[model samples]
Target: MEETKIFLITYFAALLGVVPPGLVNMSVAKTCVKRGKKNGIYMAFGASFIVLLQAALAIMLARYIFDNTYINNVLLRAGLVIFLIMMFYFLLMAQRKRKEVEVTPTSGFRSILKGMMIGVLNIFPIPFFVALAAALNVHGDIEYHLLNNTAFVLAASLGTFTTLYLYALFFAKIEAEGTYFARYSNYFMAALMLILVVITFIRIFSQ
Candidate 1:
C-alpha cells in the first residue's frame, strides 16, 4: 500500500472514530455550555494530547493490550465508579448553584489539568486503534514503525480535538438559551453520566 493512503486511512479512521458520543465530548459539552468555549477548547486540546499518546501505545501494544479482556473489564468498572463520583459532584454543584453563588469557569492550566485527568481515564481510544489495526491489516498484523505511529497519533489527536470542539460548540449554542441553562448544565451532564454508568454496569454484568 502507498504511504499516503495509509496516512489518510488513519486520519479519517480517527476522525470517524471520535464521532461517537462519549464521556470526553460530553464533558467538553458541559464545560462549554456552563463555562465557555475557550474552556471547552482547552479541555479538548488537553484530552487530545493524551489521546495521541494512548493511540500510539495501543498501536504498539495492541496484542498485549486488546488480548486481555480482564483489563478492559476493569477499566469499565473503574469508569463506572468514576462516573458515580462525578454524579455526586454535579449534585453538589447544583446545590451550590441554588444559592446564587457563581462557580468559576475552569481556564488556563486548570482546564488543561482537568482535561488531562479525564483523558487519562478515557482508555476507550485504545480500542479505537485496535479497530484501526484490524482495518489496516485485513490478513496480517499491523506494522507500527515510528513514522506510521507518528502519523496515526497526529491524525487521531486532530480528529479528537475536532470532534470534541464540535460537540462543545453545539452545547455552547445551548448556552445562549439563558442563565438557567448555564446554571443547570452540570446537572444535565451529571444525569447523562449517571445513565452511562448504569448502562456500563448492565453490559458488564451481561458479559
Candidate 2:
C-alpha cells in the first residue's frame, strides 16, 4: 500500500510537472471545442495515445538504465539538460506560433496515424521520466523496476488526460458562447513554463 501510494504520488507529481505545456493542452481543447465533442474526443485520445507509448517506453528504458550505474548517471545528467532545453524550446515555439491555426482532419485512417505520430514524436517525456526514476530511486530487476515505472507513468498519464479532457469541456463551453481567451493566456503560459525551465536548468546544473 505504501509503495503503491508513493508510486502514485510520484507519477501524478511528474504529470503535474509536465502540465506546464498549457498551449498544447489549450490547442487540443480548442480544436476539440471547434470540432465538436465527438471529434474533440478523438483528438484527445489521439494526442493522449502518444503519452501511453511514451510511458511504456520510458518505463523500459528507465529500468534498463537504473540497473547500470554508469549509464544511469550519464543519462540522468544529459537527459535532464537536454529535456529541459527541449521543453523550453517547445514553450518558446508555442508562444511564437500562438496564432489560431486550423485543425484539419486527415483522410480516413491517416488521421489516426498522424495523431499517433504527433504524440510519439513528442520526445519531451524521455528526460522527464528519467529524472523521475532518479528522484524515486528506482533500481533492481527489469520486471520489477518496469512495473514500478509503468505504474507511476500510467497514473501520471491518467492525471494529464483527465486535466486535458476537463479543459476541453470548458473550452467547448466557451466556444458555444462565442468568446475567446486572450492571446495573453498563451504568453502567460509561456512565461510560466519559461520560469519552470530556468528552475529545472538550475537544478540540473547545481546537481
Candidate 3:
C-alpha cells in the first residue's frame, strides 16, 4: 500500500511540478500549433527522455545539497540567474523570429532536436525535483531503491508527456479553428518566462 501510494504521489507530484507555465510547456504548445501532433509528440518524447535522467539524478543528488544550507542558497541564487538568462534568451528569439508562421514540417528530426535542446536548457526544474526528492526522503515517505527510482523517473516522464500532449491538443484545437498561435508564440513564451524570472528572484530573496 505504501509503495503504491509513493508511486502515485510521485506521478502527481511531478505533474504539479511540471504543469506550471514555462518555456518547455510553452514550446510544446507552440510546436503543436505550428508544426503538427506528430512533431509535438516527438518533442515530448525527447523532453521526457531528458526528464527521466533528471529525475534519477535528482533522487541521488538532492540529499547532498539539502544537507548543506550554503549549497542550497548558492543553488537558489544560481537558479535565479539562469531564469534571467532564459528570460532574455526567449525575448531575443521572439524578436528575431517575429515573422514565424505555422507550416508543415519539412524536417521532422529537427523538431525533436529542438525539443531536446529546450529541455536541456530548462535547468529551472532541477532544483524543484531536487527539493521534492529531499523532502520525501526527510519525511520517510519514499524509499530509495533502484526499482522505485526507475518507477519515479517513468512517472515523471509520463507526467511531462501527458501535460505537453494536452497542451499540444489544446493548441491544435486552436489551429484547427484557423486561429494560429504560432506566429506570436515566442512573445507569449517570453512573457511567461519573464514571470518565472520574477518568481525565481523572489524565492531567492526570501531564502
Candidate 4:
C-alpha cells in the first residue's frame, strides 16, 4: 500500500511538473490559433520529444548522484530553489505585460523547436525528474534502471503533452470565437505556475 501510494504521488507530481504555461504554452497556443490544429499538434509533439530527452538525461544524472547522499540532497535543494525563483520571475513578468502583449502566429517546425529549446533550457525540469527518479528508486542493471526511468518519463511526457494539446486546442477555439481570453492566458498561467513553484518549494523543503 505504501509503495503504491508513493508511486501514485510521484507519478502525479511528475505529470504536474511538466505542464506548460507562460512563454511555452502561450507561443504554442498563438501558433495553433493562427495556423491550424495540425501545426499545433506537430509543435506539441516536437516539444514533447525534447521534454522526454530532458527527462532521460535527468534520470541518468540522478542515478549518478544517488551514490552520494550529501551531494544529491544539496543538488536537489539548489535545483528546487532555482526553479522557484525562475517561476516567480516568469509570473512577475507576465503580470507586468498582461495588457501589452499580442498573440502572433508561429506555426512551423521551427516554432516547435523554439518551444522545445525554451522548455529544455529551463533547468527546473531536470531536478524535478531527478526527484521523481529518487522516489521511484529503481535498482537493477543499468539498462534495466534506464528502462524504468524511461517509462516514468514517458508517462510524464504524455501527461504534460496532453495538457499542452488541450490548452492549445481550447485557445484555438477561443480565437475562432473571437474571444480575448486566448491572448491573456499567459497572465493566468504565469500566476498558476508561481503557485506551483511555491508549493513545490514548500514540499521539497518540508522533506
The best candidate by lDDT is 1
Which regions of candidate 3 are displaced past 4 Å? 96-100, 178-180
Residue 180's lDDT within candidate 1 is: 72
Q: Rate the local accuracy (lDDT) of all candidates.
A: 0.76, 0.56, 0.73, 0.62
**How well is each residue in 80-183 modelled by candidate 3, as lDDT tens digits?**
67767877876788677345364575366787788888787677656767777776667676677877777777777788778887877777777775334666
Best by TM-score: 3
Q: Candidate 2, after superposition: displacement of residue 61 in Å?
A: 2.1
Model 2 regions lying over 4 Å from their true place: 63-114, 138-143, 178-207
The lDDT-based order of candidates, best leading, equals: 1, 3, 4, 2
Model 4 misplaced regions, further than 4 Å: 1-14, 18-23, 64-107, 138-144, 182-207
Using Cα atoms with residue i matched to residue i, what is each candidate's TM-score against the true structure? Answer: 0.82, 0.58, 0.85, 0.59
The candidate with the higher lDDT, 3 or 4, is 3
**Model 2, residue 52: C-alpha shift (Å):** 1.7
Q: What is the Cα-based lDDT of residue 44 in candidate 1?
A: 88
The alpha-carbon lDDT assigned to residue 86 of candidate 4 equals 59
TM-score of 3: 0.85
State which candidate, 2 or 3, has the greater lDDT.
Answer: 3
Q: Supply the global lDDT for candidate 4.
A: 0.62
